[model samples]
Target: MEYITLNNGVKMPIVGTGTNTYGKVNNDYNGALTNEIPELESALELGYRSIDAAIMYRNEHLVGRVLAESTVPREELFITTKVPASEEYVSSKDATRAAIDNSLKNFQTDYLDLFLIHFPIENKEHLKNTWEVFEEYYEAGKLKAIGVSNFEKHHLDELKEFAKVKPAVNQIQINLKQPNKELLAICKEEGITPVAWGPMKAEDHQKEVLNEIGKAYNKTGAQVLLRYQIERGVVVIPKSHNPDNQRANLDLFDFELTTADVEKIENL
Candidate 1:
């Protein structure tokens, strides 16, 4: 697997597994809840070195269980989590620090490869405050890098006016179906790597591109889609509870997508 370097000098895996697939951690929207989060041990055994979860996911303890039993060393894995959005979209520095501590204890890891503010909240001060606290943690050795998720370009520009530390990464909803071109350009220009989530859902771009591309290489639609993203310098986290799917998610190393193929896929 290939890796990307964060602005802070930490190596982040290009592909990871997301834990919140069709499930609500502890909260229900309006009146509905969903399936239980998947077992992490299955994911770890399937060759996933990175696990992405959030406090809202409420699966930290479950993730911890797998980490303790896995054969992979702590240094070889990358774990990314986020701080929950409280009232007014603001967070306390001390509280954020405490949250990091709680995360370390929950995941049973010595440190985190990445920590991001989950969502854009109300006050800009609170957002900057959260980053400041993360910066402290990064210096103190609890987190290797810090970033934001789902941030619009305007939100990022607003933060840049006074941000002490620039984000090392920005996780967003990106795919051939819902590509946000402007935000992507801003991230690339600002030196923040963009991570693409929800790539294989039915709602994603049709498999015609994948199928056509696969014809040239004899690969699956999923493999073609992931390779396309990584070729564009975007990180991806495609999740699956099935063993074959999980292994397929990591099988992008065997083939290379051609420039014309990439352009053809991008054009469609």
Candidate 2:
């Protein structure tokens, strides 16, 4: 797997496995345990070192179970989880503290490789206070790095003004349809690593374009899309239940895209 160095000098895998699911099916952590455990183990067996999870995803316990049983050493794995997106948690320092502690308990680990604000709250004071809490945890060794997800330029601007430590990452949706060029530029300017969540959108036209591009490299549409993001210095967490697809996501290092091909995809 390839790696990107965050502003804090920590190495993050460029590709990770995402664990978001629709509906409340994940509420039964025990029932859903069967659903993700094998797949996560399969991902690890296929050489995935990073696991992207969140409390809102409602499967941290399941993800934790995989980690608890994995043969891979803890030091070799990079685990990330997010705070709850609700206003109650996003606006309260005590609530945020309880949330992170719960995540730690759920993950069965003392320190998270990375933790991020799931989303930006409208209240600047609340957001800044929450970030300050993250900084405290970071200093206390409960979190290695702190960041935000789904933050726009205005949101980042506000955070930067009062932030003692700038966010290390900004997780957002990026795909062929929405390249998010402007947001990426802002992240680049602020020394934040851009992480693409939906790297492959599966749109018919987009897939066709990606396939056409992949034809030149003897790869698939998904592979081409992931390669495009990696070429642009964006970390991607492309999720797939299929082992073949999971393997393909990580098979981007063997080929390189020329400037022309990169621009072609960017223009799409």
Candidate 3:
């Protein structure tokens, strides 16, 4: 695994596993769902040091359970979670306090490597109050770093004006189809690392674009896509239930892409 230093002076894994899921599945506090959902333990076994979960995902306890069984040490791994995407909690300091406490209990960890404001709220004032809680956690050493997710330039601009401590990261969607060029530029300028959520888009089965790229390097379409993002200096989290893909995603370090190959795929 590779590492990058955040503005706040903390090291994070450049490539990692992100446990970001959206659904209203019924499960116990430890995330034992009847549905055949992807298991977090498999990721741990495959050497994923970072786990991204959120209160909204409602699987923090389950994430904690997987970590507990893993051989990895707590300090060696980076864990991040997000607040509810609304002004309701941010407007009330009391609400923010309760939310953070709940998250800690759910994840079963004493400290968080990173925590982010899920997104800009409808009410601007609420954003200020929300950031206040994030700062508080940082000062207390409970949270090593803090950041924002799914924020555009306008959203980041507003936060930067009032942010006492700069954001360390901005998690967003980035893939072959969605390069998100403009937002990425702001992050590079503001000293925040951009972490991409969807690194692979199911192989683009319909498009010959992926197949063409795959042929050049003797790699699969999945490998080609992930390598493309890594070339752009973006941290990606590509999930898989199959063991083959789990191993394939980690096999990127062995090969490098040529300049022309990168340009051609970027056009696609």
- Residue 87, model 3: lDDT of 56
What is the lDDT for 57 in model 2?
78
The lDDT leader among the candidates is 2
Q: Return the clash pairs for model 1, or none.
A: none
When 1 and 2 are scored with lDDT, the better candidate is 2
24-94 per-residue lDDT for model 1 (tens digits) = 43433232334344445667777788788887766666666667667888888899988876842245777
Global CA lDDT of candidate 1, please? Answer: 0.78
> Candidate 2 — worst ten consecutive residues by lDDT sum?
22-31
Per-residue alpha-carbon lDDT of model 2 for 1-268, expressed as tens digits?
7899999999999999987751224434233334445668788999999999998877788788888889999888899999866776876889889989999998899999999998877887788778999999999998999998999999998888888988999999988777788999989988899999888876798788889989989999889888888988999998877788889988999999989888877777
CA lDDT of every candidate: 0.78, 0.86, 0.77
What TM-score against the true fold does each predicted structure earn?
0.89, 0.93, 0.89
Ranking by lDDT: 2, 1, 3
Considering every candidate listed, which one attains the maximal TM-score?
2
Candidate 3 has which clashing residue pairs, if any? none
Overall local distance difference test of candidate 2? 0.86
Candidate 1's error at 192, in angstroms? Answer: 0.2
